[model samples]
Target chain A: MNAAVLLINVMALAGILVAFMDDREKAILSIKIAFKGFMQILPVTLIILIVIALFLGFVSPENLSGFIGQQSGLGGILLIGVAGAIMHIPAILSFPLAASLLEKGISYTAVAALITTLTMIGTVTLPLEIRQLGKKFALLRNGISFVIAIVIALIVGVAMEATLWQ
Target chain B: MAISSQISNQQNLKDWISFGIVLLIAFVFLKIYPSKTGSVIEYFWQYTMEMVLILPAVMLIMGLFSVYVSNNMIEKYLGKYAGIKGMFLSFFLGSLPTGPLYVAFPIASHLLEKGARVSNVIIFLSAWACLKIPQELMEFQFLGWKFMFLRLFFTVILVIIMAKIIEYFFEITDDRL
Candidate 1:
């Protein structure tokens, strides 16, 4: 198996072993929870996978780069950054999706911005966040997160470009 | 609580509908471009295999974390205090395998009520949202070590800065309130 698969399997094995040693009932309960969580996310995962396939199969690297490649400039970065802030998906799944976008000639900076904001800002969860943490706190956290996500992405883009070019 | 549950239920419905639409589109794409369908299926299969390998383990880690690390326990530890220690603790606790970012909001609110610094609470919330261990591992798997570590480092630094900025703004707003 590849390292990623091996690592994940080992992690699952270790988690099960630890839980079993700690409490058999809770261990079993954890497994049930895992299964439920998987089921809940499966539909979304399939949809995203299908979309990614379409994205890769149809969209050419040049076309993608024209929108968000190395020279796509600040506007392109901002656009994807906003898209990331607004779109809510499970963060773990975002990496693969982002990688696919990168493979299609989207700039690394754009992908970074997308992943950062996608994880940090949750437009869908804003109501729950405001309800729990107060309006100002929720708004500030998300708004600031968006700006920082862009900044972080640009930095990564520049750094990566420098290294890759060298 | 009722509103959140209602929202989540709506979200679930929306997701199902979207999935249905996506499936329909996939079918159409296959029919229209029989030759391209091979590439689409290939990409789909690759991602599906990767996801099948990782997602279950990720979910199990999250499940074990939720069961073992009670929110009450987190509240007791991160509720109050200030300074570098509190900020670091917030980042550390937030990075643990607990639940999603929404769940962290309640914990953060509790911490605020218990007199935790706003900066620390922001740190905690952001860390919980972005820096969970299992999520990092998945990112590592897909994005490579350079991307993963660089993004992580940048996020940590920027999160702190953002927290401090928000804290300052809130303090000004607090006086007015």
Candidate 2:
């Protein structure tokens, strides 16, 4: 199993066992609080979660590694961001995709930028944004996102490069 | 929909026309800026595919909003709250919301009818598209925190600037639609 799943399952089992051990009322109360928190946020988050899930289902994380990540380092980094701008990986699948890519041969930098900026840098979504907002606003936001994504990716890349490349 | 818009079914005719023009501009741009890579198809595919999932959320959220947040409710909660509170309130609401960007427009129009300013609506819709926090969080978990932080920072700043620009244009044109 993936790290996320393993970690979540461990937490779930522990929480359930602990709750079962505690007074039923107290455990139920805590569960209620958790449910409330989820309700508060779920309205907004559910759709994004589903979309990300669907995206990962279709696109193999493995393909991403093959295309933009290989061993090119800096070039790969920029390419990933560029690819991300065009592609659209939801939040849910991004991790698994990243993990899978990294497992194969993607450098941390390229994967980082590609995954981060994928939604923000959308060439496809640009038309929609422009339709909703204006051209100038869309351009500014996208441009700034691209620049910021590059900087963040570089920082992550450098750190990973030092550790992994050597 | 305009007959031309329907017949042509080309919402972004300008995009196709200007795409070639933009190609030339890119040539000029490269001379000045010098980019490392030379293709955007992969990136295009990425965003397009992501939207595949987002589109349904758009329809669902649109229906939800239409039902839950009525015209009167928008006027009461969202009206006259235009400065920082308005900005943040709308920002949060927009981020949390899931639907097509247009879904918000009708509600905005209703609020405007009830007295919400265009600036507020523009900011709200813009933030809705950019400040999508739930999506961002999932992205962070999947992609990592680094990607999330940068996107949030840039999206916030971009929203602010775009909001102002939108406010300006609407002010000048008195365009409500």
- In angstroms, the error of model 1 at A133 is 1.9
User: For candidate 1, what is the recovered fraction of reference interface contacts?
Assistant: 0.76
User: Which model scores highest in DockQ?
Assistant: 1
DockQ of 2: 0.06
RMSD of each: 1.9, 13.6
lDDT of 1 at B40: 90
lDDT per residue as tens, model 2, B101-122: 4445455556656666655665
Candidate 1 docks with a DockQ of 0.74
TM-score of chain A, every prediction, order shown: 0.94, 0.57
Model 1, range A1-166, lDDT digits (tens) per residue?
A: 5787688779888989989998999999988888766766777788889999998998888877778887889999999998988887878778889989988878889999999999999998898888788888889889999999999999988877785744
- Model 2 segments more than 4 A misplaced: A1-75, A88-95, A105-109, A125-145, A151-166, B1-79, B100-133, B140-177
TM-score of each: 0.95, 0.45
| Clash total of candidate 2 | 16
Inter-residue clash pairs, candidate 1: none
TM-score of chain B of each: 0.91, 0.54
